[model samples]
Target: MRAAVYRRPGPAAEVLEVVELEPPEPGPGQVRVRIVTSGINPTDWKTRAGYAGRMPDGFQVPHHDGAGVVDAVGSGVAGLAAGQRVWLYLAAFDNRYGTAAEYAVVPASRAVPLPDDASDDLGACLGVPALTAAHCLGGNPEALKGQTVLVAGGAGAVGHYAIELAKHAGARVVATVSSDEKRALAEGAGADLVVRYTDADAARRIRDFANHVDRVVEVAIAANLDLDMAVLGSSGTIAVYAAEGELALPVGEFMKANTTLAFVLLYGLSPGQLADAIRWTSGALAVGALSALPVIPYPLEQVAAAHDRAAQGIVGKVVLRIAGN
Candidate 1:
């Protein structure tokens, strides 16, 4: 089996290499998947560039999400069967083998059944972005019904899913974007209103459009704090998924509005929380409510280029074509 391995963290060209290795066998409660496509997320590149931490093993195959056919199901795995089409999540969390290989072994629970109608490319885009969006939107679908949800970076992978999921939950979705292209992307994702965040009156526009936002799915909390605060309704929650540096809370303002700031980190989610996210994401996928961003593909040998592309924060999903259709 051919795999892309990085023994050390550095620039993509310096570290990523494709080589052949024996296909790993599944252990009890695990499954071996013949990978069709591997999806790249910001976390994938960040880990590779040494932002997250050192590699867990001597060498690492990068990418936590993928779509593939089940080649073998280990003992004690009942729901998944050999030859089933599935999408994997967190395949490289603690394991050395990720989805960047011809075959990958992962816990059976991480491999969710992909609906027949869903494309393999769509399946590969689900794991990180979809799950993070689900978690950020809260667990109960009914919780968002009839409310207004504001999503920052509406054209981003997580923001794209957040828009779709919020709409599925019956929310009036508003998205903030920096350009006309992103505005169109957000609008296509079913947002009720797309506001240019660069506009001087962006907060006013959002507030006028929705009266007040019940929730905010924030990407860059530190950068958008003022705008988010301006449109946030009383008692609303700002669910932050990504941020840098420390935040100086406006205690008085928060107290007056009775607002809450919640942080969502995928890796820190409790088992129950993670389960809820997966369950919600799976349901959304089953009904065709979830859609993938535009995909940029590269073959296995060009994994380094894929990493570089993903690291550039392109508006599309970066994927590696592992197996031909």
Candidate 2:
């Protein structure tokens, strides 16, 4: 099988190489998928750069989200079988053998049946961003309904879904974008209020618009913590997806308000949690309540370029078309 293998933890092009390796077969509880598409996320590049200072000891593949057909199934895998079309999550999160290849063998539990109406590209892109957004919004059910929820970085892939899901769950949604163009996109995604964050008064202005937001779906918690602390309602939950900076908490503000800080990690979530997220997200997708974010598509051989594009801030999900059925 041909795969994009990482030899080191440096620049993407220098370390990630397309090379032929032995094809893997499914283990007792696994399935071998002929990958049709692989979705790239920020974590893919961060992992390659060794953010935690841990690099793979040997050659390893990268990428966690994938859409593929089950070409083979192993013993003890009951419900799924060969020829099933599926969307995979956590494909290469903890391990090095991810989905950026001609074939990938993952645990049966990691694969979910693709919706009948969902395209492969959509399925591939939903695993990380959509699931994260749905999980964050769905975590606190009672307060989400009839509450004003602010989604920070609204034009982002995850933020876009956060807006949609919050609206679907009955929240009065407000989204903050960094530019005028993105404000329109946020509105299109159903945000009731769109706040532009281009001023020193942005946080104050946002508070004026929302009055008090009951929840915040935060993307850059580190960058936006002060503003978030200032605007969130008392007892509100700030579900942060990416902190990407110092781990210190807003001790004074949060303690004063008794706020709840809920951190979300889409990949590596426990099985039960992921199952519930998948159930809701699948329902939303099936009913057209959730829209797949814009995708920049590339052929399989352009995998490196896809990764670069994703890192360079492509508007939405970056999908690599592995093969066409």
Candidate 3:
């Protein structure tokens, strides 16, 4: 098998390369997938650059999401078979081989079967942002029916999926975007309301749009903390995923409103939280609630470009098209 391997942390072009290696056979409870599309995410680049944490030593394949066909099932695996099409999530969570290659090996449960009608593009987009969205709201989604939810940076990968997932769970989702283009993207994703994050009256409008903000799925929590705290309804939970730095809480106001501040990091999600993300995201994908995100493709040979593109904080998903259709 051929894969994008990084020996050390640095610029994508400087550190990443395609190398031929033995394709991994599935372990006792894992399955080997012939990767078609490897999804590039911010964390992939972050980890590669040692920005997320210290870079691992030795050869490492990157990417956590992919869509592919099952080629080999491990001895103890059940409910999946060779030739089945599946979407993979957390492909490199604790493993060395990730989706940024011709093949990847992951646990049986992480290889979700794809709906026949769904495109490989959609399947490739599901794992990280979609699951992260699900993890953020998965705990109390049932209670969110008829409630109002605010999603910061709605056009972002996580926030884009959050808008649709929240709506599918029956919340009236209000999304904050930086531009008209993003506003349209959020609207296309089924957000009930769209507002500019920089507007002077953004808080007032968000509060008015939904009566009160019942939940907030924030991508840029540090940048928008004051805005979120201002419009939060009583008993609201603010699920924050990304932050710039330390967040200073308004203890008195937060206490008075009984607000719950939550954080989501996909790797640290508890088993129950992960299960909910998988279960509910599966339903949403089945019903076409989750759509294919805009993609910027790079061939496996250009894995460095894929990493660079994803790290640019652009308005689309970056993918390594490893295998041709």
Candidate 4:
């Protein structure tokens, strides 16, 4: 198998290298996948750059999301068979082999069957971003119906999925973007309204459109606290996924409004929460409720370049083509 590996964390160019290795086989409750497309998330680059600490294994194949076909199924695994098309999540969490290779072995639970209608490209885009979005939107589609949801950084990978998932759950979505290009992306994802977060009257605009935001899928909580606080409804929840710097809560205002702050870290999600997110995301995919952002493709050999692009926060999904099919 050909895989991209990093022996020690550092710059993508300095660390990532393509190499040949024996393809791994599945263990009990695991499945081996013949990867078709590997998706790069911010986590992929960050981990490769050592942000999350030392690598779990001495060497790493760095990607958690991909779309592939089941090459083999391990003992005790049920409902998944060799040759089944699947999308994988958390493939490299504690394993040295990830979907950045021609093959990857992962727990069966992380390999979800991709719908026949969903392309491999779209399937590759689902894992981290879509699952995180589903979790952030409260993991219950029924609970979101008829509510107004606010998505910060609606042009981002997670935010793009957040907007679509919120809308698919029957919620009216309001997205905040800094640029017209991003506004178009959010709008195309079906956000009911898009407002420039930098606008002087951004909060007022959101308030005018939705009355009050019932839930918030926040990307930069520290940066958008005031904007979020201004439009959040009483008793609303702010589900924060990413933040930079420390945030000092407005204790008095939060107490008065009964605001709930939910921090979402995809890798740290409890099993139950992860399951719910997967179920919801799968359901949404089956119904064609989810759509992929524009994809930027790179060959497996260009893994380092792909990592750099994702780290630069490109507007579309960055995916590595691992197989011709």
Candidate 5:
């Protein structure tokens, strides 16, 4: 298998290279997938740059999300057979090889059967961002009836899906965008109101959009904490998926307001949370309630370029067509 191998952490292009590696076989409770598409996410770049921690002793493949056909199943793996289409998540979390290759092995719990009608490219893109959206929005079996939620950076990868899932769960959505062009994109994702976050009075604008926002699906909590606290209703949940900066929170402010904080990291999601996201995403896809994937495609060899483009901001999900789709 030709795989992207990163030996040590540095710039993506400087550290990552294409190398021929042995294809892995499925272990007990795992499945071997011949990958069709691999999704490039911000975490992929961060991990390649060694943000989470030190690199391990061996060469590491990058990417957590992929769609593929099951080529083999390990012992104890039942109800799945060769040639079944599947999408995977949490690939390469702690001990597994990832999806940036011709084949990868992952726990059967991470692989869910893809619908026959779903595109492999789209299925690949759903793992991280879509799961983040669904989980952050309280992926309970019941719907979010009559709740008002706000999505910060709603046109970005995770934010877009947040808007869709929140709306599908019956929440009234207010999305924040940095530019005018993204306003329509957020609105199209079912946001009832879109506020420009670059305005001088952005916090005030957010408060005006929703008189009482019951939840906030926040991307940049470090940058938007004040706005979020200002608009959040009493006892509301602030689900933060990204806090890109190092700004300190005004603990006094949130404490006074009695706001509940849920800091989420997709890779560390609990098993039940992961299962709920899968069920919600699969249901939404089957009903066409979620929009078709908006993707930026790259070749397998150009993974670095894809990472650079994704880091540039404003680009949608980037996917590599690793094999026939």
Candidate 6:
């Protein structure tokens, strides 16, 4: 097996290298996947940079999302067998090996059966961003359904799914974007209303369209706090998944409105929360309710280039073609 290895943390070009390794077999309750597409998320690079200081002792393969076929199933793993097409999430979150290789071994539970209609391109997206999107909208997507929901950074991978999933949950969605192109993308993702973030009357536009939103799925909560605060209805919650810096809330204002501030991370979700996300997200993907972001593909050997493009903030999803079908 050929995999990308990083012995120590540093720049993507400096640290990531493609190397040959003996193919690994699945451990108990795990399955070995013949990787097809390796998805790159911000967390992958962050982990490589030692965001989690206590990393694995040996070489680390860096990717948490991918789509592939089950090459072999380990003992005690049920309902999975060789040749089953699967999509994997959180593959290297706690372990050293991810899908940035020709093969990867992950817990059986992390592999979801990919519907025939769902392309590997789409499967490559479900791990971190889509799951995070589902969790950020709250584990129960239908609870506040039919109410208005606000999504910040509608151009982002997570933001795109937040719009789609919120719409699927029957919420009227208003998405904020920085450009006309992003506005169109959000609108294409089923957002009921799309507003430019720079508009002076952005909050007013959102409030005018939906009156007040019941929930806000915020990507950059710190910078967009004012807008979120202005548009939230009484008893509403701002579910933040990403931010720029420290957050300083208007305590008095939010308190008067009974607003709740909540945060979520894909890697830290509870089992139940993870299950809920998998359930809703998988269903959404099955029915085509979610739209995959445009992808930029690099081969397994070019893993470093993929990381560089991701770190540079490419608008499209960056993926590695680990093995062709």
Best by TM-score: 4
Report the Cα lDDT for residue 93, model 6: 74
Candidate 6 Cα errors over 4 Å, as ranges: none
Mind giving the per-residue lDDT tens digits that candidate 1 earns over 1-325?
Answer: 9999999999999999999899899999999999999999999999999998785578899899999999998999999999999999999998999999999999998999999999999999999889899999997678888999999999999999999988988999999999999999999999999998879999888878988999999998888989999999999999998868888888999999999999988888888988988888888888999888899999999999999999888888999999554
Q: Write the per-residue lDDT of candidate 4 for residues 164-240, one digit (tens) a residue.
A: 88888899999999999999999999988999998999999998898899999999999999999999999999999
In the range 1-325, model 6's lDDT, one tens digit per residue, is: 8999899888888999999999887899999999999899998988887776755568898999999999999999998889999999999977777999989999999999988888888899878898998888886777847888899988889998888888888889999999888888888899999998788999999988988999899988878888998899999999998757787878999889999998887777889999999998987888878767888999988888888888887786999987555
- Clash pairs, candidate 6, are none
lDDT string, candidate 2, 1-325, tens digits = 7888887787777787888888888989999888988888888778886774767869778888888889999999988989888988888866667888988889898888887777888778777887898777865444478988889999998898888778877889888898887888899899988877556887787778778888889988877877788788998888888858676786887889999999898765787888877777766776777766777887767777777888888677888777544
TM-score (C-alpha, index-matched) for candidate 6: 0.97
Best by lDDT: 4
Error of 6 at 57 (Å): 1.7
> What local distance difference test score does each model get?
0.92, 0.81, 0.88, 0.92, 0.83, 0.88
Q: Is candidate 5 or candidate 6 better by lDDT?
A: 6
Candidate number that wins on lDDT, 1 or 4: 4
Candidate 5 lowest-lDDT run of ten: 285-294
Per-candidate TM-score against the hidden true structure: 0.98, 0.90, 0.97, 0.98, 0.93, 0.97
Task: Report how far residue 105 has shifted in candidate 6, in Å.
Answer: 0.2
Query: Worst ten-residue run, lDDT, model 1?
Result: 52-61
Better of 1 and 3 by TM-score: 1
lDDT of 3 by residue, 172-216 (tens): 999999999899899999998899999999999987776688889
* Each candidate's clash count: 0, 0, 0, 0, 0, 0
Mark the regions of model 1 whose C-alpha exceeds 4 Å error after superposition: none
Query: Of 2 and 6, which scores higher on lDDT?
Result: 6
- Tell me the lDDT of model 6 at 36: 93
